[model samples]
Target: MRTVREANRWAAVTGALLLVALASSGCVALLVGGAAAAGAGTVAYVRGELQSTLDAPFDRAWTATVRALGDLGMPVTAQEKDGLSGRITARAAGDRKVTVQLRKVSGTATEVRIRVGTWGDEGASRQILEQIQHRL
Candidate 1:
């Protein structure tokens, strides 16, 4: 009977040691995760120059502008080209209507042709197009 009791105590001690090892490994993994997140944050803040306007084609430039606008909380549903210029129409997240044009000119961008209104502005549209003109 005494031998059986001794064996049971040994088993309990083994289980306790395994738990401690697992807990230690968990703490080390958390430390590694924190370090990786900090590294990514540092890399994203690096400054860089935009490509020269002459280096980009009109189709690519217009596509990039539309994508940029989408990233800024606007979603483009339709885009069309007529001659060298093109038009882009997007609805903000709240379904606000916004329209902007792109002139294939290099060096600098030009003004916005129109702004129908903000989302559900009761038939009123604001001129946010001028500010985001570069963003297509």
Candidate 2:
């Protein structure tokens, strides 16, 4: 396990680097960063942080994410699609056109993979999924 001091130091360094990257490249850098973080999934969340949050029941995490995103602006969209597993989708009420998706992970009905986007919700589904996965 990483010590508190070590974690704090790394966080500070990360924050500084991120600020520079964002200032130079805009929020896409942040999206990429978040996706990178979320990519670790159930493994080491980072170099040392254990990803215990993802261990919760899929519904619990999905609910929490929906709530969190709702609080942030996105609201649930579609609940189902023909010939496919059910999906929990949402969108922002604002002009930005942000859409969010929570789909069941393969071979499981209880777990979900989340994705978000905008502009009629077309194309770039993977980026949305990566965005949610990286952030969470």
Candidate 3:
């Protein structure tokens, strides 16, 4: 029974109210999605890669990353490191390429990102991350 303009106004008000309610309740993640809502240590699929933050110093995490590559029988083809970040590129089974990146988050925290194959093989990436975590 309401006119189009009136109905549109009502809809806008309803949306604004919903946003305010979600913000106040700290449930705004319903709008953000994925790891933003899941908290740290949660493996997230992002940009065709799997990522997770780790609780370890950069130096230690870097070492574990190298060890993990060996433990998984992946041959490290190349590696590069700087004070703030590093990357390890390896060849996995079936000649699939894997790349692991370590970024310093704090003195004792690092963010790890792994991608397997060109587009990304989620299962392989997750397994590689788990192996690195285990080594850590």
Q: Give candidate 2 regions above 4 Å deviation.
A: 1-53, 81-85, 93-112, 118-136
Q: List candidate 1 stretches off by more than 4 Å.
A: 1-57, 106-136
Give the number of the best model, judged by lDDT.
3
The reply for model 3, stretches above 4 Å from the true place, is 1-40
Ranking by TM-score: 3, 1, 2
Q: Number of clashing residue pairs in every model?
A: 3, 4, 0
Tens-place lDDT per residue, model 1, 1-136, is: 9999999999999988877786787955556554643331111111221111222446665666677666666778788986467888887655766665655554333222334444223222222322233444
The ten-residue window of minimal lDDT in model 1 covers 42-51
For candidate 2, what is the TM-score? 0.34
Error of 3 at 37 (Å): 8.3
Q: Poorest 10 consecutive residues of model 2 by lDDT?
A: 44-53
Model 1, position 93: C-alpha lDDT score? 52
Backbone clash pairs for candidate 3 read none
The positional error of residue 92 in candidate 2, measured at the CA in angstroms, is 2.9
